[model samples]
Target: MYQLTFFLEEFLAQYWQKKPTIIKGGFKHFVDPISPDELAGLAMEEEVDSRYIAKKDDQWEVQHGPLTFDNTPEDNWSFIVQAANHWHEGAAQLVTPFRQLPGWLFDDLMISYSTPSGGVGPHIDQYDVFIVQGSGKRHWRVGEKRDDYEEEFRHSALRQIKGFEPIIDEVLETGDILYIPPGFPHDGYSVETSMSFSVGFRSPKKQELLSTFADFVISNDIGDVHYHNPLLSTRSCNGAISEQDYHDLETMMRSLLDNPHLLKQWMGEHLSQNRHELDIVPSDPEWSNEETYQCLMNGDSFNRISGLRAFYHDAQPEIIFINGGQYTLPDECADTAKQFCNEQVVTAKSLGNAIHHPAVLTLLTQLINLGYWYLVE
Candidate 1:
């Protein structure tokens, strides 16, 4: 487990979503969780999201990988592997401290290994991130939030901005954390061979939320309504959209918003949806309820699948959503279900009487067999 240097409540009240803050030695005696070689190996895997960005001959180049380093250059390049938590256990542990915050908002752990002078260039990110310097050092420059900026599209996939004054510029060493809020323009250049692990949080944009909601309504065959006015009013101009038209449309849109149940269900599923490939492997031979109970009694522990999204709403306490699906817990096991949602790891002792209950045992077996949770010694 990793410990945060500052009080989480203080940080949330002062800096979270408001401004950037640098915490020196966030983790005491920090060690690099994932090696550069391991990161490179992950980048070579087809399912992993990886990218290589470099400056070659005064021209910036970007390569989407499943990359092999056979012909790769030695310096001025970086390899970024996304969702390392899903693939590597050590990398996954990096998220432990940040889990003190809301779990549902977590994105993933992205680890990047860069050679000297390597960087992705100055760009604005739309989500919150805590960049932890894992090994070696990196000079990071973060500019204040800007309302006006012009892009210098160096590459089709990369949008970089130039001519911004930096507010925070420093070389971060091992264990140092730089918390960057959404819309903060920041960039980092490797001072030497280095690794940086970013624990990111998700904040959906208005456009994205609207698009997803539109899709949800369409998929569910709802939100279709025709305009109807009991008393038809004449408009001065035929070309102009009248106030009645605007009112009717606004009412139509409000119908969806007014349905709190539908909205909650949609939002739960949307937030639970996995953004990256999951590392799920169903049990080879499924366990029966008796076997699961026996294992629990024998001091077996349960571990949540890395990067799995599991959460419940207070209004709908019985239903727990995980990976875009919903499961309702029996009234007797509601406490245990809530515990599962709140924790990443569970021990038999923590469960107490719930482990022996039939419904809870069956649910545990199913979850374990489904690869969402696994029994561990």
Candidate 2:
């Protein structure tokens, strides 16, 4: 297992979302969990979100995968595979150390393999990221957050800035980590044939939240109350919306936001969804509740599938969300639900007597059948 040499609390308090910093030798004597060849293989898959970027003749070119390296560029090219953790178990372990942050904020583990002088160009990301240097070395330049930086499209799909005065510039060796927060302009190029693993975290924007909440409301028929105004004064102009009319309409909309239960439900469903496709394969022959329970009691453990989002709010501990679906637990099984959400592996011993409860056993069976969790072989 990989471990960070730096103190997480000090890092979070001093540098998180405030500025960019390089933690030298973050993982002492680091060993790459996934190799360049394995990353390339993942990029070849249709379900994977990968990109090939190259610059030739001072012009940038971008290709969206599934890619083939039949006519590969000799240099000045990079191959990036997004959400590698969703499909690769070894790659998924890279995110375990960073679980100190909110799990819902995590986006994915994006792995990139770059040849000498290969880079995606200077760009700004709207999400936080920790770029962990693997084998070989990379030169990274990070600029402070600035709203005045102009964005230019080098390629149709690539948005890059012309250049920025770098605040933090260094060449990172193996095991070094660079932490960059959202809105920071940064660029990195491989000093040699190198692999970099980026663990990204992002929170929902207001627009996204509003749109998703609206959809949830429509789907569940939760906020169908029509606007009502009992006393309406005659208006001088029909086109003019009165102050009282605006107030009443605003209140009507605000009523939905005021409901704590509605907000919690929306948050649980929204945050539990994985932005990338999960590698889920349901059991061919579904295990019955009794069989699943018997297996668990017999020392079998269930491992949660990589990139499956599972979480429960502290305010509503009885309700847990998994992959956009919410399940309410029995009072006696609340701790079990919390364990399933917090831990990647579930064992009969870990669950204690909760595994014996018929309701809990049934839920576990259902989840396993749905492919969210699988028996460890």
Candidate 3:
């Protein structure tokens, strides 16, 4: 496991989502967790989201994977695999240090292998990211956020911006990190063949939240209440919508948001979903609660699937959200629920006597059968 050398509090206060900064030697004597060849193999998997961006014939070219590197240019090309942490255990460890930030905000760990002079070009992301330098070196240029930065598409799938004045221009060696907040325009090219691990934090857009909330309301049938005026008043102009009518309608809609239960349910369900595919393979002959418990007692351990999102709201301690589903356990098992949500690996000793509880055992068995957690064979 990699440890961060910097102070989290200081970085959070000064740079997180506020400005861009480079932390030299963020991981002292860093060693890459995955190699370029491994990354290439991952890109060849059809279920993985991978891509190749290269400059060929003085024009930017983009190719969606499953990709082949045959006849690929030695220079001026990069291969990127999204959510590598989900499929690669070693790559997933890179995300552990960033858990200081909210887990729900995390999107995925994107690993990129670049050849010399290779880059995706100057572009702005809507989410914050920590680009960790691994293996060789990379020259990066980050600019201040601008309102008038014009977007120019080099390819149909590639969205880049016109060059901007650089506030930070530096070459990052292995173990160095570059932190860029949302809206900052930045570009990086490999000084040599290199690997970069980008841990991204996603911020949901207003429209996305509203649209999801609408879906939640519709699915739950919670906002079926209709507008009613018990005390009717005559209107001089019947064609025009009255201010009072507008206020009443708006209040009716906003009431859904005001309800704490509805808000918690929607937030839990929405945030628990992984932004990328999870490497889920359900147990071939599902284990029953008794069988799972017996295995645990016999010293078997369970590992939470990488990139599986599970969390609980403080307001509803008994309720746990896993992947897009919600479950309510007995209040006594709330701590166990929290443990399962927080821990990446759970051994029999770690769970203690909690595993003996019928409700907790059943829940764990169900989760294990669903392939969210697997026996460490």
Candidate 3 Cα errors over 4 Å, as ranges: none
Model 2 scores worst on lDDT over the 10 consecutive residues at 227-236
- Worst lDDT run of 10 residues, candidate 1, spans 311-320
Model 3, 308-372: lDDT tens per residue? Answer: 99999986778999999998899988888898888988878988888788998898889998999
True-structure lDDT of candidate 1: 0.87
Q: After TM-score superposition, what is the CA distance of residue 179 in candidate 1 from its true location, in Å?
A: 1.5
lDDT of 1 by residue, 234-347 (tens): 777989878778988898898898998888888888888989998898987998989888777788888989988988888776677888887777877788888878888777
Which of the predicted structures, 1 or 2, would earn the higher lDDT when compared with the native? 2
Clashing pairs in 3: none
| Candidate with better TM-score, 1 vs 3 | 3
- TM-score list, all predictions: 0.92, 0.98, 0.98
Superposed by TM-score, candidate 1 places the C-alpha of residue 128 at a distance from the truth, in angstroms, of 1.1
Clashing pairs in 1: none
C-alpha RMSD (angstroms) for model 1: 2.3
